[model samples]
Target: MNIYKQIKSEILNASHIVITSHKSPDGDSVGSSLGLQRFIEKLGKSAVICHPDIAPEFLFWLDTSQILLMTDQPQEVTAAFQKTDLIFCLDYNGTDRIGPDMQALLESATCKKIMIDHHLNPQDFPNLAVSDTSASSTAQLIVELIEQSGHENLLDEHIGTPLYLGILTDTGSFRFPSVLPRTHELLAKLLAAGVKHHLVHEVLNDNNTASRLRLQGYAMSQKLVIMEDYHVSIISLSKEELEQYDYQKGDTDGLANQALSIKGMKAAIVFTERDGMMKISFRSKGEENPVNVLAAEHFDGGGHANAAGGMSKLSVADTLDKIIDLVPKYFPAQ
Candidate 1:
């Protein structure tokens, strides 16, 4: 059987199906999970969305109550994993991306596993996978999967909206190089299915809180630093700073990308200090530099060529120093 048939078979054979994504759920993660879960439900199986952590407030438009966060309900999520017979892992390439607790639980699961993701160098896990690094987002892959499974009619506004969110954000609003003609074709189908593209954009991008705006200003004014000689821009936010501004999960979503908006900048890294560690977002100019390799080799993180994420056990200051020290090696000053 083909890929669609295999996934459909898993859905039809299972009683309790658990859908999940990586930790720190983004548009692609949350949207793909919700979108795929709804589709799976249409197939007559009971489905649940489980994550290792919570999604950001910007995604509040989604009825996220359907999503069970391990951070908020650890036992309940563990119970969901316990009873799952078929697991659909969306948006993340590896189980490791979902945090240690979830990773261990996922590894111990006797259920069949399927991975749907659009990230580079997927690890050797999962019983089956639909891994395509060139795809705009896993949401795009979800759309294709739905259509290929002969359920294109289910791409109604309810499903179309979240799918649109995943595609819209993951492709950087269609500006990223991953956006292809086929991507547009899928988007056209979504629009035809009654997805208000403008509102989708507005809800995800423009739906910011006043505190978040103030926080952005403060980060830009106080924390942002430009290294002219190295063509790098860096931003660091401590947990203390985040609390002072009433930090939300999604507040720093696009901060690293915004850093790269500076002229002549070749790379950007946002170092957010949290839980006694540093959470880093890395972005690089795709012209020559590949942040995925850089992050993987140096920062203990990986994603796409231009955009990736990593973590550091060192202090925030040291993490910043280490990243700054490595920039010249990747893009040496000539």
Candidate 2:
């Protein structure tokens, strides 16, 4: 039998299952977890979503009442991990993405593990790894799993909504080059299954809070710095500035993308001082302007060519200086 069939068999045999995703949950992480959970439920079995942290407030509209968050309910998450017979890891390549606490539990767990991810360089951790770096999103992989495992008939609005959300956000609403023809085909299937695509769009894009808007506006007006020589833009915000605006987790989510929208900009970097470190986000336009290498080599982070993340222990001012100094080396002036 093929791997998909084997995965289905594993799900069927397990009595208890848990679904997990990376820390600092985003659309793809939340969407894939919920999508997979709903899919598993359609199989006459059930699973629990155990994430390292809560998703940003904007995603609260989804039915996430059942998720076990390590930050809020560590004991419950721990109990779930200890009792689960099967684990589904989604949207992340390695265990480290789930943070140190969950990493410890995941590393120590003896249960069977399966991974479905779209990122590069998947770790050798899962019993079955279904990683396709070229795929648009892990949510797309979940859709594929449903069709390939012969469970396509079980798909419904509950499952398709989250899956559609995962693909839409991860692809930047189909603007990213990672999208393929088959992606649209799968989307059509989801639409046929009664996924309210317009509602998903409204819920994600139209639900911004006043504080979020103000925070984004402040970042754009005050913190944005453009490196004309290297065609890169950088935005840095201190913790105090964030607090002044009542900053929330997802407030700065779109700053990097907005900076990259400049006419001559090849890349954008946004870093916020929080949690005793500088949390960085990278966004780029073309293959020639890949930012993952810069992130990996300089900031201990890596992701897709156009988008990545990293961190720095340096002070905010020093981090900005470091980035400006390093921009020329990676993204030469155009």
Candidate 3:
């Protein structure tokens, strides 16, 4: 399939273009959208990158401050959606991933929609879809698309930096199981394209404030709970605790990973009290123990098998209790 060729043609034919991704925009979501935006701009077509929510603090250095934020500048972003001739949905499965408010605007859009995502079971909503679940991240797919589209020359530091950051972050700096041989090949190509790889890594991983570090340390020392029989470890933080530590949006980003690293641990969970809900993040060792199913069934959230997320309207304590009751049932003895 001439996938990139078709997408390039579609972009060229459109006058005004808009790009978007899921809510709580992660590295992959924000990176691929901005990378694609830069590539398209170099082709003499300017595209506005719109996101349903804000990117985490760690990703702020990506300099996407100029991008239209749906939260802060709703009218501008809404107008962009209305007037756009084409919209590229990057890193997420559907309009649902964009959240309810943005989903309404997206569904109302009469423009051609292109879905470029790496999530499983994408919804059939886009006019053109290049969904590949096996791919590590949407950033990887964007690289393949540009190369296959015969526009590899357009991938300079501007495009490569964000793309590389997405792959690095989404794959846990190439430590996750999703990092395949193809991922390395893409990294090599990106490096050759002059992406500041080490600098990007330093910026992504090392740019943490003292408060964020203290918050992480507190969560690890005071809040962790381990279930020996179920091989699960959980950490729950109340809003009071978050406020005590001056919590920010990205503060708990990798807290679940610390729990998952314990000996004999197969499942790790983090629940943070946020806006009258307990926001949950789940991670497991392998797909053999799919967490998304457990999340969807119990927590009203879902994602990849090994890395899923959910939410609970219950108070933080009750939410933690409910999860403890469930861990034994779903994650039975191996």
Highest lDDT among the candidates is held by which one? Answer: 2
Please write out the lDDT profile of model 3 over residues 160-196, one tens digit for every residue.
9999988987887888788899989988989999998
Backbone clashes under 3 angstroms, per model: 0, 0, 0
In candidate 1, stretches whose alpha carbon ends up further than 4 angstroms from where it belongs are none
After superposition, the stretches of candidate 2 with alpha carbons farther than 4 Å from their true spots are none
CA error at residue 171 for candidate 2, angstroms: 0.5
Give the C-alpha lDDT of model 2.
0.93
lDDT of 1 at 31: 86
Q: Which of 1 and 2 is ahead in lDDT?
A: 2
lDDT of 2 by residue, 180-207 (tens): 9999999999999999999999888888
* Residue clash pairs of candidate 2: none
Give candidate 1's TM-score.
0.96
Sliding window of 10 residues with minimal summed lDDT for model 3: 92-101
Question: Using TM-score as the measure, which candidate wins?
Answer: 2
